[model samples]
Target chain A: MNHPPTTATLLALLATLACNVDRKQDDVPATDPPTPHVALLTSGPVSDAGWHAGAYEGLQLIGDSLGFEVSHQQTRTPAEFDEAFISYAEDGYGLIFGHGFEYQDAASRAGEQYPDVTFVVSGGSRPSANVVPLLFHLNEASYLAGMAAGAVTAAGIVGMVGGVEIPTAKGTFVAFEAGVKAVRADAAVLETFTGDWYDPSAAKEAAAAQLRQGADVLIHNLDAASFGFFQAVREAREGGSEAWAFGMNRDQNDVAPDVIVGSAVINIPAMFLRTATAWRDGTLGGVAEYAGLRVGAVEFVPNPAQEGVIPPEALARIDEARQAIIAGELEVPRIEYLEPEDDDPPSP
Target chain B: MNRTLTPVLTATAALAATLAVAAALLALGGHSPGAVFAALLRGAFGTWDRFFSFTLVRATPLLLTGLAVALAFKARVWNIGAEGQLHAGALAGVAVAILLPVHSPLLVLPATLAAAAAAGALWAAVPAAMKTRMGVGEVITTLLMNFVAVFLAQFLVQGPLQEPRGVFNQTDEIPLAARLPALLPDTRLHLGFLLGIVIAVALWLYLTRTPGGFRLRAVGASPRAAEVSGRFRAGPVVWLAFLTSGAIAGLAGWIQVAGVTHRMYEGLSPGWGYTAIAVALLARLNPLAVVVTAIVFGALSAGGGAMQREAGVPEVWVRGIEALVILAVLTVDRSWQVLAGGGSRD
Candidate 1:
């Protein structure tokens, strides 16, 4: 809006000048430069207790462990992606971590321009020399969550609501299906993609659809949409049903603790600490890092509160499944639309 | 009769007053206002590439959005749905680009653009229908429809039209054949900017020299006066204006999609519809003038990222600066209008 248009430009201009000078200072070759700063960018609010919140936690960990001066901002557009990266690069920040794959292209371009600066995009393709795609291998935990869900579901039906069709997210769902069938050969699994990470309405609708289809246990990979899926579970249980929901992406049991049986969680803070350590020691660049369960990146925790809700045999089966997965004797089936052949449930 | 001096002088006086207030606020915060202004100038126009790319790229959406609002306002219609219209247009463009074997950039690009315009126009027609046929106030209806449109876009990408494998809810990258070539060889600025200027000029000519344009203005001034002239129906004129605005706004959406994003996402616009209101009003609903004001808004937006990157300032500060500027511009503009008393000021 050109609302008092002149006043805004002039004021913004003043700040822009102070910033650009810092950029120029960063560009000059010096024997010693100041300690490098890092910036974190997220597409959604940090309080959502899922995708964004996990990323924010990683950022905070980086600050605490590495002592890197950090900055963060929530962005609302693809255009802001380029702007934020360029600004960080020009200002001579040593590294910038964009917390989503959506920032891959922007980070790639900015990385090319700023050679001294390293750019990391979580869940993005490795696009350039200084850009590294840091992906989470969540199948390890999803498989674990699937075991818990399979044991607890009385009707032998489990549901999944996925957000968007990305490879990593698909991989987790695939492994999860394997876990479900590991306990019961005839277990029926239903999966639907809501095509968005943040649409609560669509997520709720998908959850309701699965419930009506007789799936007593539900899980979702959507970021903000997790709220809706959990809400549906809470309502179903509150209305005198024995249904449950598993939280995905982050540990969100606190979001609906009473009905949440367990959560498939990614240790994002650990990942960030590892990456920052690598960058600080100059051992990171050019390659994509895939962190899975063995490296302490993914895990599944059975809800202590829901321990008595399952029968002794079911609980025993879950324990067996967990041991097999941990001991490398079980391979969870992966759900990837990109690879249709990945349908066979892994042996637990 | 003496128009030139009043506009230029009043505009200058207004700018100074707003600056004083902003500077005072900055000083109170123990920050040097002068340093911030200087940084913005360097960031926005300091380097030619920055001006060519960041400033122009930001301006592209604003120019189209401003023109859309100006055209509607001139015909006595209020359009508060450009963001929704833009999303509709982008979605249509994406659907067509993905579905068809659009192999050639020349043919595919135009077809995609046309699809966007049509989608936008159709979306606009709903509110127009309510106002023209059912005696509904378009302001509320148009605003309300925006939420529905945004959620619909979200659904289409996440459910029906999602890319395979379902990790993220964004559409696939539009075919290379459907992409817009950069306006400059090296910069991110695309030809959509040139297109926006052309439309602005065309609308200016239509409003000033064409009879239909005159009738719309008459209606905007007073519908009874337009009815007495009997040259055209205010209903159709406003409907055309509303739909045309939607089409243009839709085109803006595709411009961002084709030229910048290269794909569709949830947030295709950051309240471009609302920003357009300020752009159109600042230009006094003059299409040609809107182009210039939109650019100013664009520069400010473009500078926001620079502020964070360069000065170690937070993103919140850049947003705060934008809000302050908007208030200053509105205050100065309103007071200037009162002072000018219907006089044309530069």
Candidate 2:
């Protein structure tokens, strides 16, 4: 019958909690060998299983291998970007990884302010003395996947379903087209962008439209929505047509073992570890870091379930092209518009 | 109890309850509740720069949208489409900035804002018409219209309104003329925040001073009573409230674009419209109190980043606190109503 007592108890608890916040506590240092602290900023949840997830895994790997204290935050808006960078830098984090191109400008601003802290932006275009872009050459692997698709398809037509028509996305499709034509000279290429990154229904509809246009093989540059592309191909196969799908970003071959031919993967965790180690060694930042087939960062992972689906001759060509790219004899087509450090003088 | 003091006491109680619950939850998750709160405070208001640049910057959109929702709810017009109307306003404002030849701030700013307001009113017209003419619930209609607005924005950014080079899935930045000047000399605090405060004051006066405002409140209190006793039709008042609410929400969108982001993109809003409901209800739908309530929510959002960086507290925990605040406020408000004889029958 006495509500006042409950309210009074709550107020007393809050007063104690407030006092506790002001009391100084012993610092429990979490690093050994006095390693610099590292952190990561992502725009989406790490459980996304694709872009954000890969970056999260990379942050964990860096922490484990380098013995650096690491933390991560999922930022929501551009307004939050600067605050996150400033917080990390001010808190003595020596290295911060922003896992998207969107972080380029904020990273640049933070890099200028915090000269001692290194900022690495994945899929970023701009570079600076303290800000580095981790150029993910997934397009190179996508081209190889295109070669595999060209060899596997019997109808001499291929399709690509993309989340958005950003330059980086279009670059993959462009390279994919060139690779397909390299294998099957007369093959037709159809491209559709769903304009959505996570909508399965829209991706499926776009994929189905491509299938109706005589494209028997489809590759999607979508992240979590690739399942819809695979589903469309599966439905087409159920309706008495032969259709296949290729995965991009992380290895998603097992997502639909029967329909997915292969995956174009960027070994994000390995790349993070290598970059963090390089930073510790004073060899990272001050320029863009390029990771491609040469560095074993990107690869066209063949699905064992789809073995023999792609002709061995096409696989041989893909392997030769991969080696050629590594040996500096072949160059993959890429869109390079995100240069945040372009204004700076070229570093040796 | 003094009537004017009741809402303040209720809000304070609700806030205390939320903090207690949040503290318990943080402790359960193996984090120091005190440390998390300290980090949040430092992040939101530790320094003057942090308070003005971070917390107030985040509060700008919330203030406008909160006032918009509070105004609409005052007349009992359930407008859940503020999100959609915001997008409509932003899209129209950005379109004018990109397509129009106006180059001076004097010319471009007003033109763009006008276009935004008109577009927002247009977006609300559909739902308002449905409610007025066809007797459809504005709740369902407004909510569904949000989907249309979101999709339209996505389509435009990806296709026609995409950056001139067609490289990114965003519109070109608004011209300098159309952009809002900074209210502070060296901070991100823009003129839009001042505009929001001015609008809130104006809305308070309009609601308290005008005969039209009295009629709107009467219609909201009892449509039959207003129509018979006040000798005025409730339908026109409802329509007026709905349109005005959409216009205010529209201004929020364009202000965000012109003030902060500088361009429209897919994730332009982090659900500020939806969050504004909690803000409005917490203020008890008072336009003047909405400013303070919006800042409280803004501090939470701005501090969430600091929690992750300084205390290693996850964003999910901050989100849990936000949800708990909304729940606690609703409960406290409901308890007051019950104590006031509304729930005595039960």
| Second chain alone, TM-score for each candidate | 0.94, 0.95
**RMSD for each model, in Å, please?**
6.3, 3.7
Fnat, one value per model? 0.25, 0.62
Give lDDT tens digits, candidate 1, residues A138-196. 88788878877887889999999998767778888888888888767799999998877
Misplaced by over 4 Å in model 2 are: A1-9, A24-34, A112-116, A234-242, A339-348, B1-5, B100-103, B343-346
Model 2's CAPRI class?
acceptable
Runs in model 1 deviating more than 4 A are A1-32, A111-117, A126-128, A161-170, A190-216, A222-240, A254-256, A304-329, A335-348, B1-46, B92-115, B122-137, B140-171, B175-177, B307-328, B339-346
**Residue B15 lDDT in model 2?**
73
Model 2: clashing residue pairs? A125-A338, A125-A339, A126-A338, A126-A339, A126-A340, A127-A341
Worst lDDT 10-window in candidate 2 chain A: A24-33
Q: TM-score (0 to 1) for chain A, all models?
A: 0.82, 0.93
